[model samples]
Target: MTVRPILETHSPSSDPSWWGAILLGAVFILAGLIVLGDVVAATVISAFIIGIVLLVAGASEVFQSFSAPHWRGFLLRLLVGLLYAVCGLMLVSNPAAASVALTLVFALALIASGVVRIVQAVEYWQWFGWLLLVSGIVGIAAGLVILSKWPVSGLWVLGLVVGIDLLLHGFWWITLGAGLRRDNRAITA
Candidate 1:
């Protein structure tokens, strides 16, 4: 087949569904905002899911350790497995409490990691030093915000963050879809 024939066959004008992408993006933005509006519940659900995942991972680890007793790290694996299982069980038993505790840990880790980032940025001064510094500052601010609210903030932090991410992604998708549609129009023109 000639190149012209192939081009015509695969042309975007042959498919007029580009508008659907914009609609999908709008829906995503709406969903993200809705989640942000009810972040507490979302956070709780997220924690619950994590707890369940931890439980399964822990159980699997324990089972695998026993199944492969000949392995050199069998004892270590067993210990880790027991630890995971215990933590998972605890989280599963009280998801609300788990949420608060997990959030607290996350906040503390963020603070520590932010400090590390700041140090790295100062010392390394790579091409992305500014980006690192800005990210570090934001991380610290976010960590402090979470710490200030503590248990209360824990209930909604994860969900709020996720909602924001989704909202941002939704905007990107919409922009991308619009760009694609514009390109299609130009091609047809």
Candidate 2:
């Protein structure tokens, strides 16, 4: 059996479908801009959505446990599901508080990651270690800045991160589309 590569049979530029990627990228960029415009609102909305997802997941887990009552772990699963539901309810009830708690955890994780990166960089100090060290420093600095702002930073950090992510994703899609178009042109020529 032989596997055929799709690209070998058809050029990306030959198909007009790549245009959709560019269009989607534009939409993502627009959404990202909107999210960035109101960090507080974005954070709250994000938390609410997460809470809803958790609620749904918890309900599903509980239902699954009940359906298979003979399973040895049924009691444990039910308890875990209940815990998830309670936590989800808490978040939905007060997204602002949930954001604060989540942000603190994020900041702490960033700091820990930076520390680990710095330590790892020591093994390659003669090569690209400097780059790693710089990245670690930046991470630590960012984490410290967020921590300094504390609860206030919580309101905006998650939203800012999400907006930046959307912008980067949009750029990636646009770049991919451009590359595909270029490849198509090259193939035709």
Candidate 3:
């Protein structure tokens, strides 16, 4: 008896469907276009849309939290949700200020995430921990650079960030779809 890996070894017959690849590619192209369009839009408008989304999400969370059976947890969640809702509403009230606020929030979040990642990397060096550390450093550096640029960076950063996100997501989707198609074919064969 021999032990085997969970993933099957690749073979020449294990080819992804052409149709699936084309479909995935089309979706990726669409996503890229949407992100590009969003980037071209004014930051204030983006901020306003974000504010509205936040407001809706917070309100829904608050309602769900309060409706829960556990009073203590409900109270805690409700309070947090209320705070978020209020902040979101404030942002929507003044889109200009909201954009600045969102930028600062993003900077802080990036810094915090970087610090957490660095700590985790120090604790666990295996399984892409080093990659996490490098990413954290890059994130912190980027946040600092954005902070230094202030309002100017805020105006242009949203589009660039969205573009990068869409690109990464599209790539991931294409890869996953291809892999799935390949696996499906392999199973059939």
Candidate 4:
């Protein structure tokens, strides 16, 4: 027996976007589950997907940087985008090696982000700065742990992250879709 979420007659979920969300959520959940089943394969696949996504994002960023006139930090953005594309291409070419490399990069990035966040918290203490500080602490700790694990962590981290992310996204979409459908029903009623 399939249980359905409660919804009003004219629910917002009746909208096409709601439907899309449902589909997206379902797909993510399915994919996440699949990946969780075989972490090694999932890690490799995740690396490849990340590479492709980064390449596309980089290309888009580079194009936009040049398309704009008198844009501030245009060169910086362009360079960053190019770097993303190159790194992505490298990931695509050798996903296994890339996964390991990416893990190291990820750990470093987390630590850097944590430090930056802590600095921001210090600068902006009045606006939930403590929260930021805590987050930064957590980030630093997590990064350190990952770094400590090194290669052993690399084989599983990417897949685990991807799986969790997908599951969360899937849940979000499913909830959104169910809500929308309920709203749609209410509206029509």
Report the Cα lDDT for candidate 3.
Answer: 0.65
Model 1 C-alpha lDDT per residue in residues 156-178, reported as the tens digit of each score? 79677657545654564565456
Q: Could you report the Cα RMSD, in angstroms, for every candidate shown?
A: 8.3, 7.2, 7.1, 10.7
131 Cα displacement, candidate 2 (Å):
17
**How does residue 166 of candidate 3 score in lDDT?**
44
Question: For residues 28-88, what per-residue lDDT tens digits would candidate 2 score against the true structure?
Answer: 8898899999988998887888788889888988999999999999999999898888878
Pick the winner on lDDT between candidates 3 and 4.
4
Per-model C-alpha lDDT, please?
0.72, 0.75, 0.65, 0.75
Candidate 4 per-residue lDDT, tens place, 35-147, comes to: 78887788888789999999999998889899984889998989988998998899899999889987888778878877987897687554345655765776677688879
Instruction: List ranges where model 1 is wrong by over 4 Å.
Output: 1-31, 105-144, 180-189
- Among these predictions, the greatest TM-score belongs to 2
TM-score of candidate 4 on Cα atoms, chains taken together: 0.50
TM-score of candidate 1 to 2 decimals: 0.61
The TM-score of candidate 2 is 0.70
After the best TM-score superposition of candidate 1, give how far the Cα of residue 3 lies from its true spot, in angstroms: 15
Instruction: Give the TM-score comparing model 3 with the true structure, all chains together.
Output: 0.54
Give stretches of model 4 more than 4 Å off.
1-14, 49-93, 105-148, 184-189
After the best TM-score superposition of candidate 1, give how far the Cα of residue 52 lies from its true spot, in angstroms.
Answer: 0.4
Q: Estimated TM-score per prediction?
A: 0.61, 0.70, 0.54, 0.50
